[model samples]
Target chain A: MERVTVILGERSYPITIEAGLFNDPASFLPLQSGDKALIVTNSTIAPLYLDTVVKSLEKLGVNVDSVALPDGEQYKTLSVMDTVFSRLLENNHGRDTTLIALGGGVIGDLTGFSAASYQRGVRFIQVPTTLLSQVDSSVGGKTAVNHPLGKNMIGAFYQPASVVIDLNCLKTLPKRELSSGLAEVIKYGIILDADLFDWLEDNIDALMSLDEKAMGYCIRRCCEIKASVVAADEHENGVRALLNLGHTFGHAIEAEMGYGNWLHGEAVAAGMVMAAETARLLGSFEQTDVERIKRLLVRANLPVHGPESMKPEAYIPHMLRDKKTLAGKLRLVLPTAIGQSEVKGGVAHDVVLSAIGCCLI
Target chain B: MERVTVILGERSYPITIEAGLFNDPASFLPLQSGDKALIVTNSTIAPLYLDTVVKSLEKLGVNVDSVALPDGEQYKTLSVMDTVFSRLLENNHGRDTTLIALGGGVIGDLTGFSAASYQRGVRFIQVPTTLLSQVDSSVGGKTAVNHPLGKNMIGAFYQPASVVIDLNCLKTLPKRELSSGLAEVIKYGIILDADLFDWLEDNIDALMSLDEKAMGYCIRRCCEIKASVVAADEHENGVRALLNLGHTFGHAIEAEMGYGNWLHGEAVAAGMVMAAETARLLGSFEQTDVERIKRLLVRANLPVHGPESMKPEAYIPHMLRDKKTLAGKLRLVLPTAIGQSEVKGGVAHDVVLSAIGCCLI
Candidate 1:
């Protein structure tokens, strides 16, 4: 078992990474006898893992209930979350009840948000089953449902009680989803850690083959990087903005393409390339570094370019509406190097258009 | 002008009480040039005060926009809040933008929750136009939108940057609404301040007539008491729960009768009387004290009893679903004496039913 504690003062909790941890009752630490929990998964993941999680909670004498929402990122809306709220109210769940999110990013985001707003706020545990969630979404406490006008436009920075990452769940991940997860895994390397990037390059084949040791190391390093960034700036006021390296551009792609069409990680994968190209154009990042970032994403089976149908001008509107835009200036995170990035505002419109133009083919 | 600072460390904000504060640009302190603000008012308040607020911000060189929602407690749902989100996204409002709530508790709660969830979170200013909001909702950070199954079931504890309370707005308030506000004014006296209770008894007529001096002092005192309580326990982990002296019962009355039919303060008024009676049955309260509580409520023209249509047994189910309920044990706030109260869990269900029965007639 590998553990990395997200040090957020009183809001801190451990992220435990291990094979078959979901079936182990002890992995759900801090939950005691008589605790009530509602496991919120999706229709797809529920049939695969719900019973095992329920049995684990029952073994610890915790009263448990389950609600499986329909699958897909398109279903991640406020109306869908209402179903969780309805089920909770119908079951008479109260302030003391803990909401356990038992699926990928969508489930974690929806369940965490339900917990945040249910009775003002309640404790929630993140049992992320997909690699994207286990490495990124579940660890950070950013819970939200997408609004029609934007992605993650409506949400809260409510942290989970603990995060239980079961590596065994990865075996069931679709090939496309596994590659989607690698996009974020690659993100940690570009924004902060050069060594991690080199490690990925060396062990890419092993990770793709599901080699236990390599997969475990990759997940743990990403968790550690995210935990430190969150601890330094929990609300994304400062250093934490670096974690959103490709999110501004990626959100534009996700919003333009419609959520669930291009998976979040895939959009981010392409957005990261756009950011690197933007940096290269601005003379802050080398052309070789931009190519390296693209090569890695390509190796992971992720998209490295914006959708060909989406004209570079198309991303401008959505980017203008991004949450990161402050004082009417669009802020884009641009990579200065493979292991370094900075949030740059006031990048000229034509320059951004040209950068997107460069990534099209 | 009177000021009470809600000392919540980094989240601390000042509550300013004055006549015509809403129209005075200076009352909106800490807002500067180049800042953006969106005023969220209701249909009722928009005609009366929205232009003045807009002009105030414009005078400060702050970019301003306005949205008027339908008036009434029934309209304080997530759907209505979505209107605010839609406007914000359409107008390209960003994280730096401030949401100004310009109405009663409903508007404050709806707008605050909108600001809290919009783009993860944003700064909001409270320009509470009703006595209920100025004295209670606006000062605290409890922002929420009502669910069909419950009131304030979905929300967050996001605080405002500042609260601007205008006494002049009260002059336009209906007679019944004034009395509704008095219920909360009377509540502060019962739950934590004996002196305030005695003052209400002595100047009931002055308060009823909207005497400027008396109303200002009443609102200021309530804000002070609430500020202290909130500072001690911002998340309602301990002392803050006492602030909901009659809310458990009040929420039931509101839910049972349907929201907007019985005003929140009116429901709370009757619920407080029910609480006093329950404490009397428990031997911690005197029959005379309960009568005094009822007499004060009657003098303010607020209801002192639950609706005759709602049976004593009807409140039990709603009470069980209260946010205060923990581990299946219903927790309630009962007054031990005038100006004193405690949160009691495990109170016998029969005693609660009998208390509600006594208040019905």
Candidate 2:
């Protein structure tokens, strides 16, 4: 077992990575006898692992309950969240009850947000099952639900008490979802770590083949990078914006394609390529670096370009409405190099349009 | 103008109390040229003072937009907040845009929560127009919308950039609403400040008459006490719960009667009386002190007992569902005396029932 701690002062928590950790009762620490816990999982995940988690908490002598929401990203909305609130109110779950998110990103985001607003905040633990969530979303404190107008339009920066990552769960992930998760793993390399990028290039097959040793190292490195960034800027007032390197374009694609049609990491994969191209056009990034980013995404079976039918102009409106846009100026995190990125404000619309035009199939 | 600053470290903000602060451009400090602001007022307050607020911001070279929601506490729901979100999205209001809540507690809470969740947080200013709001709701960072099962069940603890209290607005306030505000004014005296309680006892007539000097001093004192409490415990881990002295019972009354039928302050007024009775039953409080508390509430024209139709048993379920309930124990803030209070956990349910029965008219 490998452990990495996110150092956020009072909000600090640990991320434990190991195979078959879900079946181990010790993975859930700080939850003691007589404590109450609610496991919020989706239908798909509930059938596979809900009982194991429930039994684990039961082994700790904690009172446990479960609510299985419908599966998928489209289900991540305010109305769906209301069901969780209803279940809580119906069962009389109070502030002391700990909510355990036992699925992938959708479950983690929704449950974390429910915990944040339920009774003006309650404790929650993140047990991310999918690779995408295990590497990225579940580690960060950004919990939100999507509005029709924007993605993550309604949310909060509420951290979880801890995150438990069981590598064995990855065995059940769909091939497409696995590829989607790789998009974010590739993203960390493109945005911050050149060495990790080289390591991915060398060990991509080992990771894809589910080699436990290789996967453990990769997950630990990604978590370490994310933890340092979050500890430095928990509110995204500065360097933390770098983490959204592909998000502005990714969000635009998700909005244009409609959420769930294009998975978040897939959109981010294509968006990262677009950002690299935008940087190349601005003379801050090289053409080779853009190709390298595209190659890794392509190798991972992820989309490296925006949808063929989505005109370059379609992204402009959504990008303009992005949370990153301030004072009508679209600020995008553009790559300056394979291992470096910076937030660029006042990027001309025509330049972005031309870059999108260049990236489309 | 008299100013009291809530010292919350980085989130600290000043509360400015004056006769006509709404029309004064200088009252809105830190908002500069080219800034965008959305003034979220209700139908009732929009006709009265929305234009003055807009004009003041415009005078400061701020590009101002306004949205008037339906009046009343019943309207403080997620759906009403959606309208505010729609206006923001339709106008392309970005994160840089500030949200200014320009009415009473409902508007302040809905708008503040909107700002807290919109784009994962934005700057907001509180222009509280009611006495309950100015002294209680606006000064603290508790922002929420009511759920059918609970009051403030869905909310966040996001603070405002500043609180601008124009005392002149109270002149147009309805007689009942004025009495509603007095409930909170009297609350500060019961929970944390004996001198403030004594002063209210001596100057109840002056405050009821909207005497500017008396109102100003009363508001300043409440803000000071609230500021100290909030500063000590921003997330209610400890001392901050003291501020909810009457809220658990008050929320029960509000939820049981259907919100807006009994004003929040009116319910709190009666709830405080019940709390005093409960304290007396527990032998920590004197009957004479409870009588004095009742007499002061009567002088302010606030309710001193539970509604005639509400049974003593009805409040138990709602109180159990309160956010304050931890580990299935109903924890309540009960007054130990006229000016001191403590959070009593594990209080017998029967004692609470008898207290309600005794307080019921």
Candidate 3:
């Protein structure tokens, strides 16, 4: 097992990445034995992981309540949070009760949010089950429900008490979901670590085959990079924003396709391809590096094209309208190379529109 | 002006209590002068205070955006948060944007939740207009929207940059609101300050007429006590839970009353009366002190009774189901006297039933 802490001082919490951390989350939970806990998951995962997690927590003789919402990103809304709160209220959960998010990013985000909001927050453990979740969303303390206007429009940078990553769970992830997870895996490499990018390139086949050793390295390395960034800037007020290299464009794609339709990781994957092309056009990176990024995403079996339903004008307005944009200016996190990123502001509308034109509709 | 900092170390922010802090919130708002400021108000307080706040922020060269939702507790839900999020998206608000909540508790809670959730939190300032808001809700970092199953069911403890409690607004407050504010005023006396109880006892008549000196003293002292407790515990983990003296019962009443039927303060005032009587029965306090608390509530025109339409069983079921209770053990914050409180456990269900019996129609 590998342990890394996001040094948010008093709010700092640890992230444990290993093959079977979920079975013994209580061993590392930041609480005394006998404290109550609420494990939040969804239909798809609850049937598989609930008993294992409950039994693990039961070893501490702690009382645990389970909340299982409908599965899928479509269920990730304020309505779902309502159900979680109802379960917490019905079970008489209080200020001291710890919440365990025992599913994918949707479950982690919603449950973490419930923990943050439930009686104004309680200790929560993130037992992220999905590849997309384990690689990106679960590590950062950003928990939110999608708003009608935009995705993750309502949330908080609520740090998790601990994140228990059981990589074995990835064995059950669908192929498409695995592809989506690769998008974020590629993200860490593109925005910060060229060595890891080279590693992903070298071991692409092994990663695709779900080789335990190969997958473990990628997940641990991704979390390590994320942990360092989050510790330096817990809130994305500065360097944290760099983590959104393809996200601003990725979010625009998801929004245009109506979130959950394209899958968060798939959209982000295509978005990264577009970002690479944009950087190449702006002369920020060697055309060869952009080619490497595109090749990696293609090797991951992820989509490299966007939906044709939205035109360049549609994407221009949507991307520029992202919450990450500042003062009506587009703040695009463009990659200068596989290991470098720059937050370029005031990019001309024509430039962005032209970049959107590069998409394979 | 009196300034009290909720000494949360690095998370601490100032609470500036002055007659017209609203006129120039930018002075204390933690933002660059030209940064965008989104002021979220309600219909009731918008026509009166929004323009003043907007003009002040704009005068300081802060780009301003304002959105006024329906004014009432009924609007304090996920639906309303959507409206605020939409307005923020439409205005191209960013992580750097600051949200100014310029109304009572409902508006303050909704706006704070919006800011907390918007881009996973932007900066926000509280300009609480109602007495319930100024002294209690606004000071703490608690921010949330109510769920159909519960009050404040979904939210976060995202602290504001500053809280401006302008006493000048109290003069324009409705008589019912002034009385509602007193519920919280009485709460402080019961929980942490005997002097506040004596002050309320001595000046209930003066306070009813909105006496400037009496009201100012009540607001400042209540804020001071709350500020201290919150500084000690920002997330209601322990000491902060004590501040929910009548709130568990009050929240049940609010949820049962469909949220807006009874003013939050009125429900809280009645709930406090029940809690005091419960303490008297539990042998936690003297009958005389309980009576004094109830009588003071009555004199202030605060409701000391529950609605006849709601049944005792309806409330008890909801009360037992309160988010404040944990693992089916209700943690009621019973008042021992005007200045002390203890969070006791193992209170019998029969005991709570009896307390509800007193409030039964």
Docking class of 2: medium
TM-score of chain B of each: 0.99, 0.99, 0.96
RMSD in Å for all candidates: 1.1, 1.4, 2.9
- For residues A279-352, write the lDDT of model 3, one tens digit per residue: 87787878788778878888999877778777777777677667677777888889987788988888777777
**Deviation in angstroms for B51 in model 3?**
2.9
| Winner of 2 and 3 under TM-score | 2
Better of 1 and 3 by DockQ: 1
Q: Which pairs clash inside model 1?
A: none
For all predicted structures, in order, the TM-scores are 0.99, 0.98, 0.92
Q: Report chain A TM-scores, every model.
A: 0.99, 0.99, 0.96
The TM-score of candidate 3 is 0.92
Ranking by lDDT: 2, 1, 3
lDDT for each residue of candidate 1 in B52-134, tens digit (9 for 90 to 100): 88888899989998999999999998888888999999998999899989999999999999999998899999988888888
lDDT of 1 at A321: 88
Individual DockQ of the candidates? Answer: 0.84, 0.77, 0.58
Model 1 ranges off by over 4 Å: none
